[model samples]
Target: MTVNQQILLDNRPTGEAVESNFKLVQSPLPTLEDGQVLVRHHFLSLDPYMRGRMNESKSYAVPQPLGEVMLGGTVGEVVESRHPKYQAGDKVVGMGGWQEYSAVDANVPGALRKVDTTHVPLSYYLGAVGMPGVTAWYGLVKIINPKAGETVVISAATGAVGSAFVALAKARGCRVVGIAGGPEKCSYAVSELGFDACIDYREHTDVKTMAKALKDACPDGIDGYFENVGGYIFDAVLLRTNAFARIALCGMIAGYDGQPMPLANPALILVNRLKLEGFIVSEHMEVWADALTELGTLVATGKLRPRESISQGIASAPAAFLGLLKGKNFGKQLVKLI
Candidate 1:
């Protein structure tokens, strides 16, 4: 019998999740049935959406029930396989939850993607060449509809999705400015990530001041906005957007922690002719291969860079996840399994 370690939900988080909300436990693996593959996980993605699942409220997606393994995306190697499609030594990516080992049906719905990691790092498949990058691609291209020489602004600009937007927008000849939480991330966005300019929202005292800074960066009104942290940042960007501007509503990291919602900006929508569209990435998964192929090429050529904020062990996943919610991660956040 093989023992696998997994993080179980000890309790639902009230506001910010503490370490006590999760517990690591070991369990014996069951005999694998036909068409099943035993996977040993290597890396697990820690995303902002996981926080929503920790709650029991009705959401766009169903919440994970109490006492079940916490949900996550992972890259794993097929160590033991009764399935003909998978053999030993095949690397795969899937929605594998938080565990050192798991049994997955070979035909499990949305379960796996065979990976060839010889060129790009294996971890990159879970990040820039994977979901977050595709999310940015569809959000910016299909929803935001950025034009050449337009001014495009993105919040949480140094994060996985935001950084990807910076690269894609730049490729389209649009000027890009990033909004981040600190001087370091601001610098990272501009200097390292090749953004035209960056604003440190934490340095600004008020939304109006942030609006002024963003305006100063653009010198013209914003044409496209890829929204991630959408409270004060949304208000700030609203004040600066040009007529007929489109906003891709990617995430509202600002509202994820149960904070009081910021007042809406209906006046700007009326005056500026702004179009805000909310999107769920799963809606575009059918066309994911084309998006991933383009993103992977960019990563392979170094035109796109993915910063990984990796926690060393599965035991640290709770703390790492909390850090991501708090904007401590520099880029794509993940837990590296030993």
Candidate 2:
């Protein structure tokens, strides 16, 4: 028997989540029964959405129950298998929660997906070539449908989803502008991520200043917008949107800590005749195959190179996740379990 380290949601956050909210415990790995496979998690994904799930209130996802393994996406390898379809040493991606290992029932469809890491890194199956990339695809293709040469803008510009959005939009000949927290992120968004302009939102704190920066970055007015950070960025982007502009509302991370993030100028939506839609990527699973194919090709061809901010060891997960909530992580936030 092997010892497994696990992080469990110990208490629901009253406001902002803290490290104390989670409890770490070590336990013996369960013996694999028939139709079960044991995976040794290589990496655990830390996403903003998990913050919302931490609350006990009603929302899009079920409130993460207390005293359980924190829900998360993971990439790992099969160390032991009692199932016929899988063998030891198989690389796989799954919702294995926050733990060093998981005993998955291989019979459950979509519970574990075997991945080929010859061309693409296995960890990418949790980021660029996985849900984040698919999220960018859905928001850009299905909702914000921008034509070539149109101006597209996104908040959290250098994050996992934004990185994918920039590549897809650039390939389509759209001029992309990004809004990020600091000068470093802004520069990386423009110089590395290939954005037309990247606004450092820290410099423009209020809606007026932010909107002015948007005006300068997008002279043609924003035709499409992928919204992650709401409040100031959302209000600012709305002011700069062209007539018939489409906005894909992804994550309102500004209000994730239970803070109120009311739109300061929602009348602009009507004034500009803009279309806005909020989406949960998991709800749109049908287009994932096509999205992954394109993303993988971009990655394989050396077009879409995404960065990662990985924390070492499972013990770092709680602290790393808190940093991620504060815009501390660049690109995708992950914790290496091995």
Candidate 3:
């Protein structure tokens, strides 16, 4: 019999999660039934949206119940298999939750995808080539809809998703300006990721100044704003959008800390005729394959690069997740169990 450690929801958090919000518990591995595979999780993906799950509120995704294992994406190896579709030693990517091991029915809804790690790291299945990459692709092409020579501004520019947007937009002949929290991230956004310019929001006094810096970097004006931070950055860019600008409203990390929703600048929306829209990645699963194919080509050809801030061990998943919301994570944050 095999036992494994799992992080369970200790209590629903009020605002920012503390370490006490979760607890480590030991549980016996489930018996492998027919058409099931017992997996030893190797990598766990910690994303900003997980923070919303820790609360007892409702959203597009179901809320995490107390005493249940925290929900997340995991990439792992099959230790034993009863299903013909998967065999022992197969690597997979799926919503394996925050458990050291999980028993997944091969026929289960949204069952894991088998991964080929012969050429890439197994963790990339959770980052650049996975959900985040899909998100960037959809937001850029479907939502923002950048035209050639247009200016696109993206927040969190060096992150897995953000860097993907930067590279993809540039490839389409759009000018890209990225906003990150620190000098290191800003430099990486410009020097390595090849952004037209980058603004270190941490050093700037206010969003207006940062927006002005972006304006200077993009003298023509912002045609598209890929918003990750909501409060000030949204307000700043809203004031500078050109006529018929598009806004892809993604994660709102700035307002996730229990802050009241920032006042809407509807007047600007009316004047600029801006199109602001939000999306949940689950809603766009139909296009996942297309996103994967396009991003995979970019990656294989050395056009796209992804950075990850990795923590060791499944136990570190909570801290890594907390760091993501706090802007401590440089890119996609993950925990490697192996």
Q: Which regions of candidate 1 fall more than 4 Å away from where they truly are?
A: none
Per-model TM-score, in order, reads 0.97, 0.98, 0.97
Which candidate achieves the best TM-score against the true structure?
2
lDDT-superior candidate, 1 or 2: 2
Q: After superposition, how far is residue 145 of candidate 1 from its true place, in Å?
A: 1.3
Residue 221 lDDT in model 2?
A: 94
Q: Model 1 clash pairs? A: none
* Candidate 1 local distance difference test against the native: 0.87
Q: Sorted by lDDT, highest first, which candidate order results? A: 2, 1, 3
List candidate 3 segments past 4 Å from native.
none
RMSD (Cα, Å) for all candidates, in order, is: 1.3, 0.9, 1.4
Give lDDT for model 3.
Answer: 0.85
Each prediction's Cα lDDT score? 0.87, 0.93, 0.85
* Model 1 Cα shift for residue 276 (angstroms): 0.9
Per-residue lDDT of candidate 3, residues 48-80 (tens digit): 888877766656778888999998899999999
Name the weakest run of 10 consecutive residues (lDDT summed) in model 3.
Answer: 255-264
Q: After superposition, how far is residue 58 of candidate 1 from its true place, in Å?
A: 1.5
Q: What's the ranking of the predictions by TM-score, best on top?
A: 2, 1, 3
Per-residue lDDT of model 1, residues 1-338, tens digit only? 37888999889888877889898999897579998898889999999988888888887889888898998889989899998889999999988898888888888767877998977788888888888889989988898888899999998888889878888888899999988889999988888899999998888858888888987998988999998877877888888889999999888877776776665677888888889899999887776888888888888889998788999988889899989999999899999996
